[model samples]
Target: MSLLRLDGVEKTVRIPDAEPLTILRGIELDVAAGERVSVVGRSGSGKSTLLNILGLLDAPTGGSFAFDGVPVERLRGRARDRTRGASVGFVFQQFNLLSGRTALENVMTPLLYASGRAFWRRRALAAEMLDRVGLGHRLDSRPEVLSGGEQQRVAIARALVRGPRLILADEPTGALDVDTGATVIDLLEEVAAENGAALVVITHDPAVAARSASRYRLDAGRLRPDEPGVAESDEVAA
Candidate 1:
């Protein structure tokens, strides 16, 4: 079954003293559970905007988003939060860890947002997730003491804590060096599959996109599927 779907979605932002800008215009896509989709595009092509809409961090100005067989735009407040928590996980370029909190605490934050679980139950689950992400030894360390890769691993643990059905990653490796970035990608793909979650990776690097099962590219505010034979290196930005 399709875990997530977006149809005819459009998003526009209005500046205080400037004209409006349309970040995503009538975009459509479907992601099957356990499928890995790579969204590739040039800078300013709305890939991140698409990720935001899918992650439920931002709403599209028009059209609809269906996640795990539920319509999303019409939902608000707790209802939307409930669905997003149950179905979506997000990883970003910067690991947005809480500076004052330990890595375990940061990962536990998302589970706290989850509706049904009690604190003690979620706490145990969070620790297991951090251990799976290979940061078991640093669970009590705060973000300031962790390396970039370690911090991102914490972010990944946070995303997984809710047991989400879909994983939306926006330039997750953008801030790390190439080797570290690849290792991060490896962990992401492994965990997503292990959990049976669909993966949507939005990035500007074609080489990164190549790691996925399928790829799409956005240009000039529109999205399209690339020819099957397209090489990841060939899609690299000039």
Candidate 2:
């Protein structure tokens, strides 16, 4: 079964004294276990909205979304939170690390809400993940003291510490240099593959999008299979 399925999903938001604005129009996607998919879009093309829906942070206003064969609408309140917390991991552009926390502590934050062994061994798991990301020595370093690449590595380790089933990365390399960005993407893909987790990367960079096995372009609230040369042209234009 597909780990995630979205059929004709739509999202609309109401504005004061104005017509409802639609952000996503009929987004159709399916991600199998351990698959890698990329969505390329310019800023304000609803990429964030799509990522939110995929990550279970927001609901689609119409159509259907199922995660692991269960309808999203059916998972409500605590169930929804629990399911998301257990199954989905997010790596964002900003890294989003707590300023005061060390790399190990930042990674351990997710496991604090976990149950049993994960919660009990959060420290070890976090340290192990940091090591996996080649930051074993930096575990004691805070975000402010780390380089952009190191900070992003910490974010990635934190996101994957609980062994989530789906990894959602939104412009994860946006703040890094080209070489660093490439390295980060490699690490993300490697870790996701090791965990047998589906990876969904959302980015405007053609180089990043090219790394995925399946690629789609999000434009004006619609999604379509990426056409040959389209991404290159878009990058040139940008």
Candidate 3:
């Protein structure tokens, strides 16, 4: 069975006076365990909206979505929150690390909400994740002191510390230099594969998208297989 499936998923937002705005239209997708999927789109193509839906941060207004054989719409309240917290991870363009906290602490924040051993051993798990990301020596360094790439690595460590089954990255390399971004993407792919997690990368960089086994283009709120050589012609936003 697919790890996650979206069939004819649609998302529409209502405005006060204007007609409803549809961000996603008939989005059909399926991602299997340990798969790497990349989505490339221009600005306003609903990539972020799709990512939000896939990560369980938002609901679709139409069609259906299922994660691990369970219908997402059927989960309610804390059950939904707990399921999302335990099964999904997110890495954003800004890194989103706590400014005043050390790398270890930033990574440990998620585990605090986990029950049983994960809560008690949050420190060790966070440390191990940081080490896996090659930041073992910088565990005590704060986000302000870390470089952009290091900060992103810390964010990746935090996202993966819980061993989530799905990883959603939203323009994760947008803020870094080309070489640094390449390194970070490589690390992200490697770690996700190691953990046997499904990775969905929403990016503007063709180089990043090309690395994934499955590539798609999101245009005018529609998703389709990426066309050959189209990445060079498309004007994607950073």
lDDT of 3 at 127: 96
lDDT of 2: 0.92
Off by over 4 Å in 2: 231-238
lDDT, candidate 2, 117-214, per-residue tens: 98999999999999999999998999999999999999999999999999999999899999999999999999898899999999988899999999
Q: For model 1, how does the per-residue alpha-carbon lDDT over 102-195 read when each residue is reduced to its tens digit?
A: 9989999987766555455787888898999888898899999999889989999999887788898989989889998899889889888888
Error of 3 at 19 (Å): 0.6
Indicate which candidate wins on lDDT.
2
Please, what's the RMSD in Å of model 1? 3.4
Best of the two (1, 2) by TM-score: 2
* Cand. 2 TM to true fold: 0.96
- lDDT for each residue of candidate 3 in 107-165, tens digit (9 for 90 to 100): 99999889999999999999999999999999999999999999999999999999999
Name the candidate that leads on TM-score.
Answer: 2
Ranking by TM-score: 2, 3, 1
Clashing pairs in 3: none
